[model samples]
Target: MQDTLILKGHILHTPSPTQLVAISHGYIVAVDGVVVYCGKTLPSSYEGLPVVDYGDQLIIPGFVDTHAHAPQYCNRGLGMDKELLPWLETYTFPEETKFNDPEYARLVYSAFVRDLWRHGTTRSILFGTIHKDSTVVLMKLLEEAGLSALVGKVNMDRNSPDFLIETTEQSLADTKAWLEASKSFGPLVKPIITPRFVPSCTSELMRGLGELAKEYDVPVQSHLSENYGEIEWVSALHPESDSYTDVYYEHQLMGQTPTVMAHCIHLSDEEMDRMEETQTMVSHCPYSNVNLSSGIAPIRKLLEHHIPVGLGSDISGGHAVSMAKVLMEAIGLSKMKWVEVDNQYAPLTLREAFYLATKGGGTFFGKVGSFEEGYELDALIIDDTSMFDANERSLEERLERWIYIGDDRHIMKRYVAGRLVEEPK
Candidate 1:
């Protein structure tokens, strides 16, 4: 018989908005990895199983970071004062160029995964450096760490520094190789197509990558309308197209598969309509927008239009790994948008913001980000005593406090696919 492990705690399942649920599970025979059994008394069948009781700890679904650059881990906080293009030229490109060395890739990638584990992000969508070797290094590290991730080998063929750019043929060949190499990566790690952005990729390269997406049926991720200058640059580069979003649409890259566009801050109504019709997800990286002077994403507008919006760290651009900080930044930036941009765009509440950090983003991966019955058992055991007073509080309050003030120190345990992989000291 497979080993059975029962976790008992105040479970905050993000099912039907925010509700507390009791969950129990064992290997293979779990309730689709979501602990289905909930009650004050254990079911008769669970009586003899080994139970790990977390008295008073808040058990919630593991955090899902919808967008991050794994290669930019070393460059976090380095180019804070510059706007998009200058920052790319002065700091971002130079830092990413260093990943050509396999040893450097291993060192940084290992540390990146460790930070994600420490911060309680068990599942992530990551952007790897353009170097194939380094991208592979990232995949191996995520696998070893037992993280569930969708990672991509970045594709850039034009408008970048010569050292960082690949020829159109070389870009397609390398990306195809990376896809083929990822076939055996197992469920925990999967490959996605990453076109650097509309400006860096020519029409030929973008169309070719779209073909590859069709061949492999993998997801595609890239930037869109992140900065005012970037939008103008895309317009200049693809004058034949109607708008920045139209460039991808013309190349057949949108709607055919799972697509995530980071930072849709300045999208037009037509772009929003297309995104909604195609079901493309937007990764709202608020900190990066504010830090780089990029515009705040109209998240309220996006959600109102039924666009799927999630959160991203956009490291080096935004400077942190903890999705906890991203949650705070998301709400903070929205309030700024309301104050400075439009009063009609009300600020996001704590529940809505936390939902974006968890279930809203986890939708990219089926059935994740909740402890409801039949969902995957990706979870975190958070110890919030540091902020808790002896005074009684509800489970929702504990979760709220943890999101606002907690760090890795508060993550008592982490589980993925019913397997206990990380335990706090």
Candidate 2:
């Protein structure tokens, strides 16, 4: 493949949360995997560069799914009527246990990656079950398909079912091995330490993993304050901690490394202060929050605190994989928070939601989620003619329609690191 490529399309990207940069007919030039130029017209200096003209199609930064469970793909859209704990026991754990079989993990993860690409997700932070080999299988599939990800071998030493539990010693050993094995993957396919959450991981295990994270210089991802029941359970489990965020901090999981805690829907003022102080990130999963009857996150407040916040699919908990769908749910849920709870926490703008799905979440992966110069070109090409978000709508209006109603069918092509990503066979 040529190192230099040019593309012409209707483009949309967010350089800032409040700003939506759109060009009705724009051209993007990339070379050696970095975007060199993106503007309304083809640069005159590059006269002969081959241009892939996707006339009238929407070209936006690829969506980033900041938190997803690869093993739970099978359980999506099923058992959603129940809340968090019961749903996990009945559907999630049993389904995740099936990953002990490598072939099962292979099938599920392959389909999951293809679906992620089909839905225009170019990067993600994904969780695998406790099976070490199966988790590696997920990483390999992601690497093969040209997707960027932080794939973790889940760590849970207690409070899990007997079939899924691990000894603290065994868990730490497996995690070290998993990290060592991940060195073989492409640069984009890195490993992260995942302790599952406060309830599942014992303090000893979290401390060990925290040490490993520091030693290896790897980032971490986990759930936080997702459910009231889960919070109560964590409180009961670790009474010495001042708050849910404090538990992770006390164990050295939050502040010592890059950490993203999902579904921060319920947090105390002190917890918020700690999160803001530590520069800890939050993966806001609006669909999961509402689906599990968890309270809507105070996203406006988080943004107000200048804390880094991004959108997540929260797979299985969130029934959809498309960030477009997540964006819609996020905006609607924000409205509920504003009218139903506090007017000071106003509803989120469409621009802000798009930023969360793209640039905001992309910050986790560094220099992704935009067409800015020198940024890796992970982009999506879309044909939204059929949806008509509105008939003969302006480019911005069409984008809004896509956010409100588009699906994978609207995505014509996807690219990661300037290389086109094909759907898995």
Candidate 3:
């Protein structure tokens, strides 16, 4: 039962947020898609196995995108001038509404999966629209593509445009059916309960969805405190609640289930405490926050508080599929906050940003995002040598340049769960 692959290169990974484990002359051995050995030199116990020598290439764990809209991949870069609410109405919903057609879902989802792999994102948490058939298509495409992901069927019952709105009863029914039918899909591709956001869902709908989440024991993902208008709207709609985070806590949408909240930009001190206390994950979408003018998230503070933080390419709003781009943006945005907002917090380090892009986000999927033994071998091999001058560049500098400037052209090979994803010729 052991099919082994030995990759020799410059290995770089963060085993923990504060620790960077790099082996300049490293050898990683994966047996049946899981890393069994990773060290500076190959052990003699496995001397004769064929090795894939990446030479000077940099080997790192595949990126984990904690938030994305599968249906809105088509909307990237077209509606950058707008903010959250108007962006939703003008660009997002209209494109998502089109997913009611199964063929369109198949076409776009296939491309989205290809692009995700091309960009070194082997695992993700994705959003699909309310249409059940297309949601199934999206799941099938990701499953077929061998990507590890959680794709959700977004739920919205009230205040949405008529074209996209669903009755409270129908929304829950569809979500239940989707969860039940997910048994046949690949183990890596599963469902998450997605309620869109507080402004869009009725109180009754949220409670019912919460009940389903408990009944099915599934993880949940939704937007939280992204835009100023959205936050005020959540407060206005739920007056009894103290803050936007309190609304979800009141409705059983927070703390009880495994949760990932996107865009915690406008979080209050109390909300931040609540998130840390309850072990909630924050998906920092800096590009989307800047593009939508939704203020920068205090990620340094979040990490200081020891809250689980991860990077998300909130596609369309983010305008890029590459986690490499998002990683650089995260560092840049953190520096902006440090200088303009608070100097004591300091700018994010490349090591910390790398952790968020990989292991930090990969936490939701259990043992992923690193080369440590027993971790899933979800990884990428990059040839950024072309981007570097002939002068010797350290392993660290090459990675930095790749984060800020390199593209898919640098990704020579990709592996998800230890299996290579060969680009279609």
Q: Which lDDT tens digits does candidate 2 get at residues 282-316? A: 99998899888888999999999888998999998
The lDDT for every candidate, in the order shown, is 0.85, 0.91, 0.90
- Given candidate 2, what's the lDDT at residue 328? 91
lDDT of 1 by residue, 1-425 (tens): 55555777777765633343444322212443555654456678767767788877777878888889988898898878899999989988888899999999988888889999999898999999789889988998888888899999998988899889999999999999999999979898999999999989989999999999999999889999999999999999989999988899889789988899999999999999999998999999988998899988999999999999889998879898889889888988899889998999888877778788888888898878875556777878888888857887777777777788878898988898777775321
Residue 421 of model 2, lDDT score: 88
Looking at model 2, report the run of 10 residues with the lowest lDDT sum: 387-396
How well does candidate 1 match the true structure in TM-score terms?
Answer: 0.94
lDDT-best of 2 and 3? 2
Cα lDDT of candidate 3 equals: 0.90
Provide the lDDT at 97 for model 3.
87
Q: Estimate each model's TM-score.
A: 0.94, 0.98, 0.98
TM-score of 3: 0.98
* Stretches of model 2 off by over 4 angstroms after superposition: 388-390
lDDT of 2 at 69: 91
